[model samples]
Target: GQQVMQIPQYQHVQEGEDFTTYCNSSTTLSNIQWYKQRPGGHPVFLIQLVKSGEVKKQKRLTFQFGEAKKNSSLHITATQTTDVGTYFCAGEVTGGGNKLTFGTGTQLKVEL
Candidate 1:
């Protein structure tokens, strides 16, 4: 079974600080996906990485995939109140049935 693990399960940052979360898989992944879930809100798909060593950014957020396709990372340039949420990484293992294993998740809290 494929398992995804994330570090720094919880974070508290002052507004304007940078934040980052890492995700790793027990097996090589066919694809990696990132999601954000705000307090009292459902999870929202942020992005997906298919190619090895791929990097993508959206506004103040950056996402990266390891060359081996077994790890990924998400970084936020600046912490803001709106950025407070739990970040999750989901991965699909090679040859594994369409099931996606999600990481433990990293919770971010921004103080004004």
Candidate 2:
């Protein structure tokens, strides 16, 4: 069975500090997508990486994909209260429609 693993269900950081979380899948993933869920809010799409060894950045946030497409990481350079949220990684399975399975999720807490 395929599985997605994530670490640090919760994380706290001081303002101006850095934070990072990792995601991994038991089976090789065809494509991966990252989502963010704000407190008391639903998940929102952040980014997706399809190619092996792909990397992308959004402002203070950076995302990376493993060469095997089975793992990924997200790094935030500076922590802020506005950066508080849960980051999730979803993978697309070979079979079925929109079979987007999500990771356990990394809850991020930024202190001011």
Candidate 3:
């Protein structure tokens, strides 16, 4: 069984400050998916990183995949209240078929 873990389980940032969360996997991953879950809501797919050393950006959010394909990170520029949520990284092991292992998650809080 593979596991994915995220650092800084909880993060508090003032509005307009930058925030980042790191995710590491126990084994090499074929792909990784990022999701955001708001309070009392279901997880919503944000994006997926497949290529090693891949980097993608959506608006003020940036995502990066490690060259080894065993780690990833998410960064947000100018944190806002709307960014409050639990961020999760799900990884699919190189030969694990369609199964995905989710990380412990990082909860982000924004304050004015």
lDDT of each: 0.95, 0.92, 0.97
Estimated TM-score per prediction?
0.96, 0.95, 0.98
* Candidate closer to the true structure by lDDT (higher is better), 1 or 2: 1
Model 2: residues with Cα > 4 Å off, grouped in runs: none
Evaluation by TM-score, superior candidate among 1 and 3? 3
TM-score of 1: 0.96
For model 3, residues 75-103, the per-residue Cα lDDT tens digits are 99999999999999999986677998999
* Candidate 2 per-residue lDDT over residues 1-112, each given as its tens digit: 6789998788999999999999999988888999999989999999999899999999999999999999999999988889999999998866647798899999999888
Clashing pairs in 2: none
Off by over 4 Å in 3: none
Question: Model 2 scores what on Cα lDDT?
Answer: 0.92
lDDT of 3 at 1: 70
* lDDT at 9, model 2: 84
Better of 1 and 2 by TM-score: 1
- In angstroms, the error of model 1 at 109 is 0.2
